[model samples]
Target: MRTNTTPTRKQAPVINFACPSNQSGLTALIARLSAAVAEVEKWAPVEDRLSLEFSKTADKPKVKGGVTKAQQLISDGEPVLDLPATDWFFHTRDAIEEGRAKALAEAAAEDRAAIEQRYVALLADWDAQEAAYNSKKPRGLAHAKRMVSKAHRAWSAAEAAIVDYEPQTLAEAHELLAYAGLDGKRVFFTPGETDLKTIMRNAAAAIALHGLN
Candidate 1:
């Protein structure tokens, strides 16, 4: 039995290069790299087999006491070791590709969250505007109702003032009422002398009186 006394040296760190300027670009790149790595890894042998073979060859004595066996080993083991390079490259590539994919996925999730937040803010603004419009609707309707009442009163008084008059239709009365309301004038009648209700009643009385004549 040969006593194994070769000191182990740490393996060189693998190099990696995977970065993106933007989130979308990063996601696309990651996907492409991961697929390529997966295809390569599928055909490659397991890592443990490669590691064991490489370890045995690497641990073989470079110098046995005074005799140099490194040259002899290199000539014999070089071809065998060369076959495992493809498998080693595939494993290293897969690790890098998987890491990039994970990073991209995380970034995309964050982007989606940001967009949702913006939509929520916009919806809140629209709701506020709708609430304001609804709040003002009743007040606007009340003001319009008051204006209509005022016009009806003014037209009634005007029609009563005409002593010799042709009877007007309801449609014509409504038109006249609208015009009187729009006409910018303020008239003051004494409470007993002439009220709008009294004027309207008299107008009806005049119509009946004329019919009798």
Candidate 2:
């Protein structure tokens, strides 16, 4: 019976996400928050598994050749004799689970307050940013169309008649917003339900870009 004396460890799970260049501080913070969410997902499993390191080495000193009970048993049964395969599985599992519940309760108690703070801050920041974006964002369809470009009469005419011109994607919307000389790309993560969408669609976006050429 071969046994390894290597100790237990916890390796963090990899998270894959990156905020693009020239993004606002909010986007950078949110990218980090995504990683934190991943860590939260691994938290319970790491607690359940890596916490076993305490069971493995808490009582033992840092001395070489420390004989575990299984090692002692193997030594007692020379030449691999009486090396039983079946190992201990606790029969009184409910009590063990009760202890688990108590342990997890303690851990959650320590973390829950900070988690709440994080949530509150995130919402507050989002509101602040949305307010700022809306403050500068042009109001009304005609204003936005005029912002896009008044250089071409026919292009302006094409855009002037449209009712809904919001772009389909955030990037295009931002580009359109830039043409309108307004700030669009910085704060928003998803498509907004505003007049901004008017310049985002094909007809309006094409009109904004090519402009009746």
Number of colliding residue pairs in each model: 0, 10
Name the regions of candidate 2 deviating beyond 4 angstroms: 1-23, 53-213
Each prediction's Cα lDDT score?
A: 0.35, 0.38
lDDT of 1 by residue, 37-154 (tens): 3433432333434445544544321111122223222465455333221211112323434534554566676576665554454445445544554454432444444443443333
Model 2, C-alpha of 50: deviation from truth (Å): 2.0
In terms of lDDT, model 1 sits at 0.35
- Best lDDT among the predictions, by candidate number: 2
In model 2, how large is the Cα lDDT of residue 130?
46
The residue-level lDDT of candidate 2 at 148 comes to 27
List per-candidate RMSD values in Å.
42.4, 24.3
Where does the lowest 10-residue lDDT sum fall in candidate 2? 1-10
lDDT score, candidate 2 = 0.38
